[model samples]
Target: MTNLTCFKAYDIRGKLGTELNEEIAYKIGRAYGQIYCPQKVVIGCDIRLTSEDLKQATIRGLNDAGVNVLDLGMTGTEEVYFGAFHLDVQGGIEVTASHNPMDYNGMKLVRENARPIGADSGLKDIQALAESGHFQEMSQKGTTEQYNILPEFVDHLMTYIDPAKLRPLKLVMNAGNGAAGHVIDALEDKFKQLSIPIEFIKIHHEPNGHFPNGIPNPILIENRGYTSDAVLAHQADMGIAWDGDFDRCFLFDEKGQFIEGYYIVGLLAQAFLLKQKGEKIVHDPRLVWNTLDILKEYDGIAVQSQSGHSFIKDMMREHNAVYGGEMSAHHYFRDFAYCDSGMIPWLLATVVLSETKQSLSSLVEDMIKKFPCSGEINFKVKDTQKTIQKIFDHFADQKPMLDQTDGVSLDFGAWRLNVRASNTEPLLRLNIESRADQNPKPMQDYVDELTQLIQS
Candidate 1:
């Protein structure tokens, strides 16, 4: 049997030609159909040049395996997630590599109601079947049909906030020439029909496979200047940018400063809690103080989960959480079948802005000051476990409280840090934070100490 390296812990991702190609895509589709044997499945693709051909091959495999296909042409990841749960299909697949390089492509799969299918949940089975080239013959073949899910998807997004509460505000949006442009256009049309007074200044808003601007990842420091610059030049209220598949969005305040996703978690938690008291909110372990403080004041329950989307989604389903936010900018909502959405976060942030009559920075400035964080720092390491043990030994004398949920989190009362190996890369990720009132040392001091320790 041929080993397939494209199957990852969470989803399928690999470099094209060698790791993944049309033939392999077909095998994946056939394997999924053989294992699940679902009568109907929903599928969509991003604007990548190779995506359409791969999608067609996948469709052929699904049809050959007797599973009908509903194709949503050119959609972001969440759109496929929406179709999986909202439509009468039993599963969905999104042909997207997100922020990966042009030579790479991937797929995100979900079962009924948009529940993720990670390695622990049926991904391994599909991989085995595909690797072995197993087949089951059927007399009847399934059919393929084209469908438009944008209108329904946009309508569902509107349910997250009240249009009446929105004020006249200007927004700067940079789509990075990916799949997000079409969704933005549909939302803009809806706003005009409803007479909302929000103005959108769009840039790089067309879907071009070449990615003329970049790969659409706003998380990179180099890719953020365009969005921030446009926000400042237009005097906009807020600026938003998204990655290729548009699953996670990064935000910039009115002053053109990039707000860390950690603070946005607290902001979103407060927004939901204000509307309904006693709601549950899930957050990752990487950063916690700001979220906990806000939840305590709002009389909301806070639950902590590991750092991945599948783990966070499972925890949200278990706790019936109203909202879940990761410091990595992935936000999940109970209303959206516990799936993460790039579009939802910014929409809710706008509502918060209008309701409080405050700027984006003002709403989050206190949280940033109260709990200063070093964001996330990454380093390529030779041995992750050995490095973690070294750090633990160094801090053993202080007897800091430790939490090993997703990584090693050491709480030293006044300041805390979490260091973990990256899930998708061979790198160690670190995040440190300090309570401004409780610690006399600056946040940068702790950052430098950790950097030196990790490097040495």
Candidate 2:
């Protein structure tokens, strides 16, 4: 039996040939079928060149293990999540590497009701079973059939905002040549059919696995230029871009300014709170000041969860939270099976823009100015845990408040810093944010101090 290294905290993602491939995918399918023993399963794939082959191999394994499959060809991760809960299928899997490099591909799995199956939640068991390369006897061969879920997915997305309420606005959409193009086209048609005028300036609109316009990640400073430039050139209402799988989206204002995911969390929190007050909002520990302030002003409850999909989804369900967000562009909704949707966030933003009659920048300007953040800085350290302890020790003198919801978060009076090790890599991720009324110097000063501390 070959060792499988693709499994991670939340999903299966790794290099194409060495860590993840067709044989491993087949083993995973067999293992999942044996473990869950579901009558039927939904399967989807992204535009990666290897994802289709992997999807087929997994389907074969599932069929051999007496599990039927519904193939939703080339979709985002959220689509699989939607199909799992919405369709009659008892399980779902999406073959995608998300924002990973061109040389990689992977899968995200969910059980009934689209509940995530993370490392602690049956992923390790699946890995063990796959590594063993053994399975139980099958009763009979299952079957496979094609299924188109685009219309249903788009219909569900429309529930967040009334079509009649959506105003005519010129916008720029950058799909990054991933799975988002299809959904964009579908939504465009829906908008036009409803007479809700929305002019979308499409860039890298076609689905191509090669990623000709570099990787479709707007988080990186370098990859943000295209969206910002197009937004300014077209004088659109806002600019939106997504990762390879289109699970997470990044936004920019009309002035060609990239809005941090942190502010979007607060913006969406307000959007939800306005619709239904006193509802709970879940957020990660990485950035809290802005989101908590918004929730407080709206008289909404705020819940803190760890910074991963599995953690956020579980917390959202537990708290019955209407919305959940992380600083890293993932936005979740209770109506969407507690799964994050790249489509929902933008739609919500557009509705807010139209209703408030505010520019995208103006909508989030005060929040950004009040709670300036360092975004998220990653340090490739030799000892992540030891480095975190060292930094915590250095800052302990002032007697800062501490929270270990996700990572070691130390809160001084004016500014706060979260030092957490990356779940997938050997790097320590640092995020610093200051209170709105305070000077920005404290945030930057702490960043420099922490940078030197990590280096030392």
Question: Candidate 2: lDDT over CA atoms?
Answer: 0.91
lDDT of 2 by residue, 1-456 (tens): 777889988889888889988889999999999999999999999998999999999998899889999999999999999999999989999999888778888999999999999998999999999999888878798999999998999999989888778788998999999999999999999988888888989999999988898878788889999999999899998999999889899999999999999999999999999989999999999999999999999989999999999989999999999999999999999999999999999999999998998898889989988889999898899989899899889988999999998779998868899999987655799999998686647667877888888998
Q: Once model 1 is optimally superposed onto the true structure by TM-score, how far is the C-alpha of residue 397 displaced, in angstroms?
A: 2.7
CA shift at 75, candidate 1, in angstroms? 0.5
RMSD of 1: 1.4
Every candidate's lDDT: 0.93, 0.91
Question: Taking the candidates one at a time, how many backbone clashes does each contain?
Answer: 0, 1
Poorest stretch of ten by lDDT in candidate 1: 420-429
Q: Estimate each model's TM-score.
A: 0.97, 0.97
- C-alpha-based local distance difference test score of model 1: 0.93
The runs of at least 3 residues in candidate 2 whose Cα sits more than 4 Å from the true structure, single-residue gaps closed, are 440-442
